[model samples]
Target: MAGQACLFCEIVKGERSAHVVMDAPDAVAFLDARPLFKGHTLLVPRDHYETLTDLPGEFLGPFFEHAQRLAGAMESVLGAAGSFVAMNNRVSQSVPHLHVHVVPRNRKDGLRGFFWPRQKYESDEEAADYAARLSGGLT
Candidate 1:
């Protein structure tokens, strides 16, 4: 279940806003606001599950299925050479909501290590496009 005020919960209910990339009765995908790569995306269950252990077995199957589809789509659409999927739990997670990050990787991107430095946004327009392009793939 989701609380009415949770940011992700609002996105699930079609309230607030997000550039959603994929949606189903049980899961939804959207671009990560703070991305490590150009097309980084997040896939989350519509219901609130704080950790992997909290999720029912049935939900896990479809969630990963959708993640795979979205990862493939990102590779093709974003011209990414590879991708990484990760989920953080209580110790590492900043948000309690359960979600997975699907990040696109490219050989030429010049990322020296797993922890690449983040860049600052110069304009709102760029952010808006990032959201829209990711959301477009949801369909």
Candidate 2:
């Protein structure tokens, strides 16, 4: 886990701006600035933990439960068939802090197995709209 210097940590601390989706007691979900799809969202712990091994045992269930909630939101709110929920322990982890990528997906969305093609929203407003919908689903 990185310290306060981590980018996600900064966002969690409100030092950085993110199109936040939801703020749970133990985790936070937000739209990915660089999305794999229009509704791609990231779920992370409020506290910093670099990799899976670093996460406390008590944190595991709630973390995945939140991820599942976000994934369901991707379908119900965004019209996705389902979601691609994943995390990289260390090797493919872009951020030092552990996070789950709850990417909305449909069959033949060009995501072959685990090979994802990165995408972007038309604008921040568009991203915010997605955030708002997913945020609402969290309620």
lDDT of 1 by residue, 1-139 (tens): 4333567777888986766777789998877777787667788899988889999998878889888877787776676788888898887776677889898887877677566655533555666676566556543
lDDT tens digits, residue span 44-124, model 2: 899999988999999999899999899889889888999988899989898989999999989888988666788888888
Winning model by TM-score: 2
Would you list the C-alpha lDDT of every candidate in the order shown?
Answer: 0.76, 0.89
Any idea what lDDT model 2 has?
0.89
Taking all chains together, each candidate's TM-score versus the true structure is: 0.82, 0.94
